[model samples]
Target: MPADTARGRLPGFFYRFAHPALAVVSTVGSLLWLAGFALAGAGVALRASDPTTAYALFYYGSLVSLAGIAGIAAVVAYLVVLWLLRDVLDVLDWEKPEPGARR
Candidate 1:
């Protein structure tokens, strides 16, 4: 077993970072997305009177929304990785390298 495969589970470093990553993606990401929605709605409301400001707000909202979407995507990716690694953390002998082969 190599250092990366310590104890047949994900690296300790990954665990240490995963918590903060999930927190940022799940919490802050959601808040940003909602804020984007609010801004875009405000833009729509003001479009008739102030097209300039409304367009600016709409542009900003789009950018913020994209950022939020990226963050949320990261969270989903983390879930998928965790799901794939579930057995790795559970079963110690799930994988056994074959060192000998005759071909």
Candidate 2:
């Protein structure tokens, strides 16, 4: 039987929901990282005009960039875990006979 038609429904449900949710999170993280780069650039420009304010902007921008990196790493780690689960499921399903496979 196909993977989706397996007796246990939990794996199917997780495969359906988790993939898209992770994709959304990864996309948002990438956007945040890009925004951080822009902020850093603005901070550089401000450095020439106002040294004190520029320092604050640079500090906060670095923080934002670090957060973005963390988010991306988390998403990647989760995806790897999901892939491992999928492989395990595939192995189990392969070993088990389908509904009417046996004579």
Candidate 3:
């Protein structure tokens, strides 16, 4: 999903950090995500320019792209773990209930 749509996230569809920190992390993650698309696109375009070079470029691009995705997944895993224990961490929470409201 586009970074802008982070605000569009519906309650309960997914969990998110209620703190401002999530904004910074989300933006950075989105920008870093573009590397995958760029590499894959370059690989696609290179194919018509030169067959032999295209194979190498595509091969490496695919590897790099997959690595980038894996890194992102790892980060998400870390955040998920933290989020699940937000009450104990006392740092971030997915939502803030109203005053006197039950969580």
Candidate 4:
């Protein structure tokens, strides 16, 4: 046998850092998206006073919300896939490269 030539798993702290950072990033991204919702709400609420301005604000706010949500979802999905892949690699002893090889 080749003695399972893979290197040892990454430290728990490293995994912790990766996961928490991803989560924080996801949350911040989502909050950025929610800001669009707030802006839209403000625009609608103010429409009674200024229809033209409020209409423009609402359109921009909706666009921002859509873009923000899409971006956040993409990022979160990517991170989740990486996290899952890491777990699978750990389970299968695939995280580390072959023996005697650079990472």
Candidate 5:
């Protein structure tokens, strides 16, 4: 006899709750990530060249370049984080109080 089952699976209810939560979290996380990348990109552009040059490069060169890199990073990061959480997030047990204390 052979085991017949999916290697990794989450409960349906868990998915129902997690789908919306993940969407909300991923949306906010992505925005924050991109905003930080934008700010940092601007800062680098400003530091790398003069104000006039920075304006030109930022508006033209850096925007396109950083956009591609940041987009890739965001996708990879989101996937990796979600994959790592696969096991940990499925557990629903609550932590017990300290051993010395009564409830």
Candidate 6:
């Protein structure tokens, strides 16, 4: 088998750097989403006492939540594309050349 043909193998830079970077992004996205929900809840609690403040909190919280969701979606889409490409490459057997062929 070629060096790149091992199952679950990724390029060195991707495995070492890109994957970890995406993981961190995913973690941050989730945290931001959670914070948005907390803020929105606070807005709801304050709605009766301070309508203007509540509206601002709700609006900003929704924007933050949407941004977080978009970030996570983008990361997931990238990963899915990577997975599909890997599967297609595996199916094509592109890494294995003729047995006697020279490198």
Best-fitting candidate, scored by TM-score: 6
Root-mean-square deviation (CA) per prediction: 12.3, 10.5, 8.0, 12.8, 13.6, 10.5
In candidate 5, clashing pairs total: 0
- Candidate 4 lDDT over 29-80, as tens digits, reads 6776798888888899989998888888888888878877876787778866
**Overall local distance difference test of candidate 4:** 0.71
lDDT of 1 by residue, 17-40 (tens): 636558656667788888899999
lDDT of 5 by residue, 1-103 (tens): 5344453233332355535445445455566556656755776668755677556545655455455556556656876776666646844354556888765
The 10 consecutive residues of candidate 3 with the worst lDDT sum are 11-20
Task: State TM-scores per candidate.
Answer: 0.62, 0.64, 0.48, 0.56, 0.31, 0.68
Which segments of model 4 are wrong by more than 4 Å? 1-18, 83-103
Instruction: Report the error of model 3 at residue 55, Å.
Output: 1.5
The list of candidate 5 runs beyond 4 A from truth reads 1-18, 48-103
Q: So what's the TM-score on candidate 1?
A: 0.62
Candidate 3 lDDT tens digits, 11-102: 32334444445545544555555765776677688888777876776677666666656666766787788867786676675576789985
Which of the numbered candidates is closest to the native, going by highest lDDT? 6
Q: Candidate 3 — which pairs collide? A: none
Q: Cα deviation of 10 in candidate 1 (Å)?
A: 28
Residue 41 Cα positional deviation in candidate 2, in Å, after optimal superposition: 0.4
Candidate 2, 9-100: lDDT as tens digits = 64555455536677657767888888788888888999999988888888888888888888899999987776676665453333444787
Predicted structure 3: clash tally: 0
Residue 85 local lDDT, model 4: 71
* TM-score leaderboard ranking: 6, 2, 1, 4, 3, 5
Worst 10 residues of 4 by lDDT: 5-14
lDDT at position 102, candidate 6:
62
